[model samples]
Target: MPAFALEAEQRKWCEELRTLAARELRPLADAGEEGRINRELLAALGELGLLGRLFAPDGRPASALDLCLLRESLAYSCTEAETALALQGLGAGPVALAGTDGQRARWLTEVTAGRAVAAFALSEPGAGSDAAALALDAEPDGKGAGHGWRLTGSKTWISNAPHADVFTVFARTVKGAGSRGVTAFLVPAGRPGLGGEPLEMLSPHPVGTVTFDGVPVTRDDLLGEVDGGFGVAMRTLNLFRPSVGAFATGMAQAALDAAVEHAGTRRAFGGTLRDLQSVSHQLAETATRVEAARLLVYAAAAAYDRGEPDIPRRAAMAKLLATETAQQAVDAAVQIHGAAALQRGHLLEHLYREVRAPRIYEGASEVQRSIIAKELYS
Candidate 1:
């Protein structure tokens, strides 16, 4: 690889992934319910060894660059599969990062095998992007539960909630501690007071609110030390942030490709749409922005893999640029395709819906800007 460009093998692998997503994964995604977990699709990813790649073949974690490539390639042809794969990583990532051997042996195996689902339960209704402001209380259990704590509160907008077999939950273990008081726990779905309800959203993924009515967890269930959960969450997000950009870049590339093809072939006033200076110019700009976003994503991912200190800033820049560019590219595609793009089942329509949420989730665009600004001064 020439510093910024992908190596030949990497490019070949990405092409293969795109083809596999289109041919093997798309059908499973098409058959799944709009807002439900697609177990079949997940299973297909596992069977193809995509899920296992979340961790490396040597039991060590995979590189951030590998994650970006996988996500981008999958998103290029099948956003649903990309989302499913990403969620698996997001929800179970902490375990691979800080979990005990027992926890890894139990959940990570099932997770990678597609037999067990996992969720990262960090965002509460009151704490969306303000992670440190979370108020889920973790009071000590006094019912002879032996070093256990009782978690009481609710988490909203959690991906794969109400259905995940396990959750890496964050809660406030000490009052007045801000981020310092938070703790991470691995709580199974069937815990005594654990329950959840699915929420309908604009994007087609399983998101919901989980209510913890004094859910019990022991020290054995803790992920990392008490009050160390915030670090765990941040580490996971730092690694994933650039890959989120990769996801957006893939979507943008797809939209740009569609727009270019349409402009080249779709008839308009006396000639093909490409002959129109207005249409061609818009495409030229969109293509440039998309490529720039992809390069930024690659750089950020590479920085993360290199264990550089400025990862936060790079990740934020990559995500902010790529996601914003994806929205623009999709909108431009829809505009070029005109009303036909708005029709049901149109590729542009699906992308139009899919493109809006990345801007909001996993730390919104506004939040990304804040991080970048803070990091610059620090």
Candidate 2:
């Protein structure tokens, strides 16, 4: 498949996703509270078979391109639904990659069914972008080799926290080893010494702090090899990065569409906003940028699917361009719409809140640039 254009069936699927998001998912999103898990919406995604698509029954995982398309289509109309779906994939992905058969048989099915909520607990108050700087300690139990470890420390800015049924937690197991010291544990919420509380945030998702006092995790709970959690995290990030760009592109496209419609109809100085060269020019520029960002996202996903080298550079470029373009497109859309766009319930207002976080999460824009530069020099 070409990076610039999707196949006919793919395009049709995207259209259907957009319609489903608008007609079915949007209402569920509206009925749910902000900064909390929406089980209903998640269940709906499962019922529609969207969540199940994240992992394949044939043991072949879904391609990065499929993830990109699913994310972009859902995001175009229902950012909340898109976020929920993405979070599920992020939280449960490590299990699919390196879990034991029993683990996979247990939690994965629940996750795909949306019966169990999952959270990826990686970032902490002191280590948001520097994942290797993680401070969460996984102290070995002196009981013996199979005795397991006790987790101690806190993970902040975690999505679906305080409510998720399970968490893929990264903790410093070999301290002072930088990225090499970490270990990934599949921690269940009902375990002793595990606790969390939600935090109010600018974006409309559940973000919070999860604390571990002496959270006991046996070897059975380990996702990957001990002291190899960083690689698992990176692998998960690599897969999801381009899909993040797809999400941003979806928002940009939505913003551009809104701007174009407003410019074509709303009366201005002497005529419609489209008659003014400044408004028309801004819309045109934004449209071009959005298309460029979308193409970059597609190209990156294609590279990942094809197992191409230099994926880090392309993924970073795609995320950087698409997220930045989304911010610009949203800001332009708001400007064209004037104060009406700022109205609390306006689509642009929702998108305005939605657009800023992508540049920070997954990987910040600065982080992406650093990744791109490092890959270039290497």
Candidate 3:
């Protein structure tokens, strides 16, 4: 695909996704309880074969471009669906990337089919952005060489937590080793001593806190080499970061479209809102910013697809700019829509709430800037 323009097939696929989200996913999302996982939406995605696209059944890693397209297209019409798809990819990414054949066969298929929910358990009470500072302790169970570890700690701000059928949990294995000490574990939800509670959040997504009380895992639960989980987490983030930007871009575009339509139709000062120079210029600027952000997101996704070495910097730049731009675009859209935008159930109102969280989650804008600077210096 071109950096600036999607190919014909890509555009057609995006259109299909948009249609599916609007016609099928949006209803399920609307019927879903806020702050909870929508299993019906997941099942719909699975039925559409959209979930299967997140990872290759042939064992190849999912394409970054494909992921971005899926997110952007779905987000344009149904953010809940987009989030469900992204969470599946984010949580099960490590398994697809480096899990043993048994692990992949067991979890990945179920995840794709929406028969099982997955959660990425990396953040803790003290370790939001500083993932390496995670305090989840995983002590050896002392069952000899092939024995499993005992996990005992708490993980908060975990997406799809408590309710998810499985979790890719990160725990500290080596004392005082920092990043190198962290190891990834695949823990099934019903294990003894594993429990969690839902956390009500500004974004209407399934987020919660999970507690591990001497949770035991066997060798089969390990993801990748022990004490090498940091790489696994980083790899998944790097792959998904650009798609995060794509998600933001889609929201921005939706807001822009809303603003444009409202401006053309709503009369103000004896004319339509679009007749005002201020409104027109603001919309123009917002549209331009959205387009630029979209380009950056596409470029970053393309770079990742090409296996470029500068993906860290590119992905950071894309996510930072796109998320910030989305916030701006959504705000401007609300502003242009005036009091109606703030009313309950308004599209702009929903977007206003949705746009703020992306800048904070995945990686904060400050964190993205830090990544870009670090990549530059390195």
lDDT of 1 at 333: 97
TM for every model, in the order presented, reads 0.98, 0.98, 0.98
Candidate 2 per-residue lDDT over residues 71-125, each given as its tens digit? 9999999999999999999999888877788888888789888999989999998
Winner on lDDT between 1 and 2 is 1
Candidate 1: residue pairs that collide: none
Model 1: lDDT of residue 29: 98
By summed lDDT, which 10 consecutive residues of candidate 3 come out lowest? 56-65
Task: Report clash pairs, candidate 3.
Answer: none
Query: What is the C-alpha lDDT profile of model 3 across 104-170, one tens digit per residue?
Result: 8899899999989999999889998888899899999986789889999999999998899999999
Give each model's whole-structure lDDT: 0.93, 0.92, 0.92
Clashing pairs in 2: none
Stretches of candidate 1 exceeding 4 Å from the true structure: 143-146
lDDT of 2 at 274: 96
